[model samples]
Target: MKYKVTQETELLNFLLEATSKKRNDLKKALKFNQVLVNGKSESYHAFLLHAGDEVELGKKSRQDLPFPILYEDKEIIVINKPSGLVSEQTMHNKSETAFMIVNGYLKKKKEKAYLVHRLDQDTSGVMMFVKNKKLYEELTHNWNDYVLERSYQAIVEGTIKKDGRIENYLSENKMQKVYVSNKKGKKAITNYHVLKNVKGYTLLDVFIETGRKNQIRVHMSSLGHPIAGDRKYGAQTNPIRRLALHANIFAFEHPFTHKTMTFKTEMPETFYKVTGKIKK
Candidate 1:
């Protein structure tokens, strides 16, 4: 269901007057992130609503998803992808994937989804897909030009005393593992700053200049501080029982509209649990 706001009011009050559902039900919807304003999820009931705003009560999709939809429109859809799911199906692996889940949801609406980019199977956070072929081609052809920022949050196994940069060439073996190689390999660069150090863990804010496969994982491992639980890169501990890396921020310009778009998700609670810091 959708509503066009005619007057300024608090979101909860506006919903109360606009919908036939009880207050408790509306509150529950807000809590579960079933409400969206102008295509973005708004969980705060006290958020101010103004005239000319588009309010949507998102009904549950037929397909069950482990992740949450952050934003969607006729042109594109963004999701906060959870860990342990492949971004898309592979030649050998035809099992469930993020693409399959989003495609299923769109199929229910008589729409189609196109792959834009990918995240590592163990990496969690913002991912996007285009709804049409034109947009897909535009983005995939000029990805670096349209993408303004890509950042991540990670909990590495050791303490990093200062901000640093890592630059090296990376190559992948037949086994699908990526390693640093200077012999005809792709150059990758990553910059990181220490966010906090708790116990034996170090939380880092990471940015990448070139999106090579496994760039961050290889770079951090070179510094002797592999991401927690990333055994593939020499991590000694599994404090979180999952890769402690997350792609938390993605900012880009819409290929068709040229409008700035940004999506972000909070670091998983398990990250804070291992770091002994509370998320605020």
Candidate 2:
């Protein structure tokens, strides 16, 4: 089966509709890189349709959302992304990432969705996507003025004394991947609470007033409380397969109606365990 394009429906919609009708494997189309548009394979999920676009399901697109949707509204959707998924993909300097998953899902539903903020590849928990371009512009442009707070939960390798504050300069590493900083870098500050201490590790509830690239990772590493399971930092041992970090909540202003919006996500059971207590 096939579909004809329309202004209301996107290319992704046509494929989803067609695939839903058949027992044929949609996952196979996406995984084997079998899907194509206008006689070309397109892995990127946000490929906008301008009408008259042809699609073939080679392998079905993987429905791995990475995380669960904690909250949603007309203006925004808050998702708790699992560890090990990119926020968006890189195509023409763009990325096929988690952001596109939400966008594609809404597109299939005939609604709009756009990226407003992101979490790291290994970082789990709360993230937001805005819909309308106008609303997106407002939130992004006025992010400093709009959002009230953002909080993260992390299990670090060692106990943090004082359950307190840290301030430092941060900058991205150009030669090496993953953002890092030393001195003479942008100012980065993180406030943390040592909620739980066990064995040789500590669980921290972190808050970052400013959104910087890998701010939490770098800052915590510098403070000598590197997040548990972070391979990039001081946690040399593979205690866990993925980093034990998560964004539990993100608060911001509703771009459309000027209302204060707060989104919270629950921690996965693994979040509570460090080295030995992997069982739920």
What TM-score against the true fold does each predicted structure earn? 0.76, 0.70
> Pairing residues by index, what is the TM-score of model 1?
0.76
Worst 10 residues of 2 by lDDT: 23-32
Q: Whose TM-score is greatest here?
A: 1
Which regions of candidate 1 deviate over 4 angstroms? 1-64, 278-280
Best by lDDT: 1
Candidate 1: give the clashing pairs: none
Q: After superposition, how far is residue 174 of candidate 1 from its true place, in Å?
A: 0.9
Summarize candidate 2's per-residue lDDT along 1-280 as a digit string, tens digits: 3444555454445567656634234533432345666665443333455577667654333443424566777767777676666887654236457777788888887888878887887787788887788988888888888988899988888777667777777676654444444676777778998777778888778999788888888888877878877878777644555688888888876655777888887665555446334423
Residue 268 in candidate 2, Cα distance off native in Å: 1.5
